[model samples]
Target: MIKETFSKNTRINKKVCLTTDFVIAGGGLAGVCAAITAARAGTKVILVQDRPVLGGNASSEVRIWALGATSHMGNNNRWSREGGVIDEIMLENLKTNKDGNPLYFDAILLDKVSAEQNITLLLNTAAYQVNKSLDTKIDSIDAFCSQNSTHYTISAPLFCDATGDGLVGFNAGASFRIGAESREEFGELLASEDESNQILGHTLFFYSKKVDHAVTYKAPSFAYSHEEIGANPRSKNIHGHDSGVKFWWVEYGGIRDTIYETEEIKWELWKIVYGIWDYIKNSGQFEDVDNLTLEWVGTVPGKRESRRFNGEYMLKQQDVVEQTNFYDAISFGGWAIDIHPSEGIYSEKPACSQFHSKGVYQIPYRCFVSKDIDNLYFAGRNISATHMAYGSTRVMITCAHGGQAVGEAAAMCKDLSVSPKDLLEKELIHQLQQRLNRFGHGIPGVALDKSANKVSFANIFASSELVLKNYESCGDYVSLAQSAAQLIPLKKGNAPIVSINIIAERDTEIVCQLRTSEKPENYTPDIINKTISLPVHAGKQTIEFDFTDVDVIDQYGFVCFLANQYIQLEISTQLVSGTMSVFNKVHKAVSNSGRQEAPANSGIEEFEFWTPERRPKGQNLAVSFDPPLPAFSKDNVVNGHLRPWLNSNAWVSDYADTQPTLKITWQEKVELSEITLFFDTDYDHALETVLMQHPESEMPYCVKSYRIRTAEGKLLADVNNNYQTVNTLTLDSSITSQELIIELDHPSSDVPAALFEIQVR
Candidate 1:
């Protein structure tokens, strides 16, 4: 290498210019997903990030666990995991890093983006300037990498602002708001009477290790003393077991300007973190922590609230609580309106206030497009939403879901020669939704477009379909300390009589209720159909709940058993594809109570939360129907719907069928080029990105091995050790066949084989 001597007055770094179809700023989950989606859709993409790694807040640097609609599986939104690219990332992470190592997650993201040949990733680069082709269109972006000492000029027709701070939009002169809107302005019941500048604060996390011997810790001069930390009521929540995201309340700087004073905010957070550690180590309030040593602390704070760019539509409080549907809906969110106090750790108020909707709500396409900037798109926490809605949409995986929508929209826009706004005025919005649903992005009320698929018009039949009959008791008994319910799919007419085995510690009267959701699509048990009381003795007995008089339409029936601490319910180890068990219990982490209480005029409905238990524990109650429910059918595999919503939308094989197979026939020979299979990956699981360990690496119901062949038994493709939900196979050459058959290996002896929609083209 040769050293250059600069004699001029000024010297600049090396400059590089690149042109692409789409440019994305920020390398957070949102940007990574957008870049990957666009790249897969045949668009040349240039993705830029200021950090050394891909994940932004979820990186090893920040270490915040990524959660979305499932909300750590602590609410009533059943089977509501953000799908598409984010779902893939989650499943991949589970396979290799179920322990939730942040560094491994970083590598997974890098691998996903790098695998896409159409994407050019720029690391340690920050977009600092925007060149506008018109008043509302961005021509190019100027970014610089401090590590390489080089400047890059990236030009593109479409630009997406995935930067958590809305950096690109800000540089392009986009309109944005920083604080809560007035209640009167948007008619939001959750908003304050008047507008306020107060916002949620930034938080930092620190990890600890329990060594074999005693470890001593000394506080720096900047660290606050125990007496100083004791001034806040939240300090009492600290314990010896507290670590990682469990200490999410170590926050500050919400009352000040979060953008301009970021450094100051970080410093204050540092002082609080060190002070909290000191208090834990030396205050003598915590026991058995003498062997605990601080392993690492975050260098940067994870920001919660920032500049929210204005879009064509601003999602308000009612849009979430009321579960409003939009004609231009593109994505969905189900997390509660989780707002933290402005005072943060120093506040006398509780750590957070969360209000959940009865079901998942849809987010419109207008929320992802800028109002004034024609070619600008918004993703991540900076999307168009009021303070109340932002509280739910700010989560990382939800942001990534929206990013996939934006990426597909950009690809479509490039093909159609139109702007993002054009999708709203035209019928193209339906096309966009269809594209998203086809790619495993689950929209609540939307179904896949089967007009072009050959399987939609063909005759589909399976070897055998599962008929609901019985889930025998596995001898695993759980105490009825809390109310529990079994969510079962039933046909229209008289509800089936369910028999549940229970052991009573003392004589008690058990109250059982049959219920269903007011909205047929939702899982919330708001409408009570029948109430029955069963008097039991001190011994084990099988109680029958006969709901013959309760008339019900096609929907989910909740067989609820109210809390009776003296009784223990028998549970079955067998996991049905379309069935689950939920409990009316409290999850303090997400601020969920057994029953939600709202003010008279708050407009938020009050309902009991019956959420599922995480796997290895959430066993369905052992129950048998007098007459088996006709829920699963062979035709469901070709039905358009991929995931469970109003119906199971999946064809499950009978338990006795060892070698399950599905056959599709056509009247005449048809040429097939591509075939896609959708398997059940248990969308109900939350799959948190970090700090939470999953019970299993692969979903129990997923098909591990499968084969595809023609009527003559000519093997076309054979796959073994498969774990993903969507598997697409392309023939080496077009093959003409009148009949196609798919054979699958059951994931486990107990868990039956299940398949969702299948597509043939």
Candidate 2:
């Protein structure tokens, strides 16, 4: 506005130089989680993102829904949601935007990052250059923001490359692989026969809405014709009702270079999308799409695979498929080994080939540390893994979960003045896991350290504990169109005597099997301990199946009822915590076919899939247990576990206990500066980040109202409408109390009050 100045040589845009303890390049869910986790652990963090908004693919620009272990509840990993910062983010999104608007999710991420005082968020800044002080250590990162025309030079002792494409790691000359490795390379059964350049491609999504008036569309000249697309055998799936992520198969560029030809891939996707829309509008294939209009289309394609940087250890196919327990385990993943066709949408092959392990597998910390760059860490889809293993670890939420592990390692490294590799020492790794678990991060087979909690020394008691009894049938009957099973927790001994109400169309002999997982931690019903046949009458009647003679271990017993459409099982409204009913059903979206049909010699086992039904219909099957199963003990709160695993690792009060109370008494008056309470938010629920809508804003199992008090009944804190899994109460000052009391209210009339863990510091 004042004057225009011309430079004789070159004009330098606004330049900024900042220093932090940790620098994270990328603002995707992984980077966001890393930044948030590091910052929360008292580390200065700088987060750089090329996009104007955070949440990369999960942002509105791309609109890919966030998913992790739950895998749309299509697999056998029950209560397997990734914990830590990502869980908090997902829970927050569920509370405020259960409808899963991408914009709302974007805001939530931005809000969370911005709230962190120690985080310096640089949006629209792309990291293009890496400055190294040594051959094995990154010194600084050079990034530029096109929107502001500014350059940022950020230096940090630690750096996390979560850019998805491994931009920072690539520029830093970190060891990486660009394509699939041969089966012999890692001895992977799922790997290709030989090394190949072909990889998963980029995908774009579009959102359409129904309008009041009829809408017309004209296809662009570049758009493919209906006939051109019809040449593909899968074209029949194109429907007006299906848009956005539902058209995940409308992809391309796997045959080409996804990194360099992003624009080309995007154009092809656009053409495919437009061609699909045109086919629905004018081809007379869809009957009711006149009022439908495209609301939004992604500008950039959501990338699936690219350069995977090598870490100290490259995760291989067997690690995931075998549920390998690494010595330095830091995180876990449960998504299937999902590999896509190299030809993408044009291919005759299925969109994706997926194979699931029996249970969730641990991800070691070494996979997050760079093998070449000492100061560099990997996150998101770029983390070290072979092509076959990457197929499972590449999901957004899973990447975010591993990001948390590296983030905490970064913080600990700074505190100890050591590199990430040094933390691999047995004691140090345990400490790191302890720190992660303290912040609500879940690691398979790892429990919170009891020595760190003052409550571990105290005696705990509760007003009442829930005893498995009877689920009052709500008059809801589900036709046994498919085999169904109720997962019941049992101790080592005889199985419980169970009775179920079934309505039979005609007199028939119903077969019931008592099954359990081969592994105690898994939910897969792979072992059948007993099979019983009960003759039932035509009308509604209760049938008793006694398994008191059947020996069992401390695991979940799958009480299975074979498929018989002639019979209908009674459903109950009693939605208890940790207990669920699953069906051998197909969820076509996640490639679940009721059973996995792996080819012989594929190294993958064929097993039946028992997945829970989504709510509004996934009520528990009504059943009664003789000599009620002794579970949900109050002492479970001090058991060091945070979520439901082999059992309901929670202190769940009886449904009849209106004002559930827990007491912690100390031998001597102890000083407590802080008290942390872990609640049940139903970790089993998959809170999809976008597109999909959830039935409830808050988890029905969460303790909505609670009060903390001293022995004298002096209120310390009164919390209401609580919806989060973790609630930390930092007292104004250290309180000296010999006895503490916690009063809880049931989240709903039907749901009981449950608390997973309690810690005093």
Candidate 3:
């Protein structure tokens, strides 16, 4: 509710006092995402951001890529896109700003906030003062927006401090920690040996663009001379930059109080930004830069660390290394522990340290709520994490996930009239998980409760047999004499295999077979089902083997092939999971040099071969299946699985244009008010903006248009051109029907039509 208030000078001026369900501070991804989440759940929210635009560091002002599991494609995290608002923003960025303009992202963030009617956005409004009663509950927060010259006080039942520096929590006297912890504090290996006031400093980045004509540069008075730009290794790699955010190493002010000394830090960063560019343009150390000119430089420092709010669960470095699964897990983080030097660019030994996880790890809800402050919750870089663990969770997308969980928790609090800590109960936690799952947020170990699904057992789907696939790839692998043959693992399922094709590129004939693994733990082929010799004298050969009657053994099978003198494997990088590509390599004793096999001059036969390298998992192949069992199965949908099924989890269509239909027939007429569907939109298929730009389009094999029908062919509704993170249909009145049919439309992209999740409530 908005109200007009009067101060001592009541004649003219107006003071605004806004009452809301949740008052969120900071307009970064965490705060914005939290506001959106709560607003979507029908909660009144007031989101105050000090910056003129939203997205904080992600805005045009800071231009940091929204990094998360997709750390700009830096590591081996497969199928790592967190499926929620963040995924939507990522895909939207690809669709609109393919060039990755920082200016364009500002508009995206603005659109997201304005789309929700329940959200009141106060941009350029900084929340600085908080009022707490003797009971220690927050009463109101005082904020000032210079743009409108308005003195406002926002009061709410709940509040979140996503300020990156935990401004609201700090003002409220919440328990928090800053800088690195002593080694004795948490047994953290990365902790400083002795307590110290040091942290990862703020960095300033500059962008350069090339123009048609030659551009000249004269160094600014404050810019460092070439001699002053000394031997920092970052300068060595600074010439002829392409990306706008190349100089992340240009930083200062970690040794000082980062929050209090930001002005000094920004000045230092600006000097370095100018000095680096001056050295590039006028120092004569750069070449091919005649057309390059300075574009944009950050005026304010991009902060890396500040006040760390203490939450119920303090996530230490061991929690990261152990990959602990929390019972109340709300979000997951997979980025490496990237610890930067306190001195930043001036450090002689590399600028940053990194340690990667075996896979993604879970973060608990207890980590987002304050330990001392009763109603205090925070997200972004200030959440409950030790200094060492904060290095990984501080990234924007992971922080966005934390914001998402907070938003949902706030809504739950409103409904139950409980605090953030109260939701930790097993039942309430499960309720939160279910609500999040309904929105398709992937919780690490939580599966959607299947009892709520509309389909029980009667609905039957018959089309081309759907087969579950463990991998996806568009490339081919050919046999190599020196490297050994490719061994593709095929896991046994309920459905029998029809036929499989192998792409071979060799002029010489080779022997291949459907072999079983020596053991589940080992990759070596043990037993053979059928051995066949194929003539491979061509540019490319398609070898097919029918497995309609093959007997399986040990729950696994490998497609093993003999090699030729020279061969090349065609592999697809467009996929996430598929059959593993195996090869054997031999390395020298004292050196890093290695070979596929022993030299030909050796007396002993060069027969020693190892498994293939684990770089590329997706191998291109055509796998088919026959009629499936349990005519109508829960596996048809409602598995809480996000990825597409290769041979299972869906009903396959044998004939194109046949228009496959999946019908759910209940035991009796049931009331259906809502229906949700998840289709196979390839998350691994990223939109390229910088290197290669493709027109924003739907993923292949995605259902473009579809109709809802009953067993009697009664038309209910029709959906067209559906391209979203998920599809949900809600009706004004409940419909009683014994069956529900979803007629498939031909996919716009080349592939099969797929549905991952179908839920009706």
- Native-vs-model 3 lDDT? 0.69
> TM-scores for all candidates?
0.99, 0.99, 0.82
Tell me the whole-model lDDT of each prediction, alpha carbons only.
0.90, 0.90, 0.69
lDDT for predicted candidate 1 compared with the true structure:
0.90
Please provide, for model 3 over 1-761, each residue's C-alpha lDDT reduced to its tens digit, 9 standing for 90 to 100: 99867667646335799999999999999998899999999999999999999988788788766777544433333345576777677667766776677777789889989999999999989999999984457889999998998889999989999999889999998888888888778887657778777689988777888899999998789877777785656677576665455566676777778998899888877777788888887777778888899988877678999999888899988777556778898887866677787888777756666555434678899999988778878888899898888888998888988898899999999999999899999889888888886776766556678877766445655444433332233455544553343333243543243333444444656665666533332233445677777566556544454554675532334555555555444443332122334443443211112222222331111122233332233243333334322221335575665542221244444334377677677888888889888765544443332223434455544677889987777777798876665788888888788888888775742345566678888
lDDT of 2 by residue, 432-549 (tens): 9999998789899999888889888999889999998988889989989899988888877788888998999999888899999998899999999999998888998989998999
Candidate 1 C-alpha lDDT tens digits along 144-221:
998999999999999999999999999999999999998898998888899999799999999988999999999899
TM-score (C-alpha, index-matched) for candidate 3: 0.82
* Candidate 1 local Cα displacement, residue 24, angstroms: 0.4
Stretches of candidate 2 off by over 4 Å are none
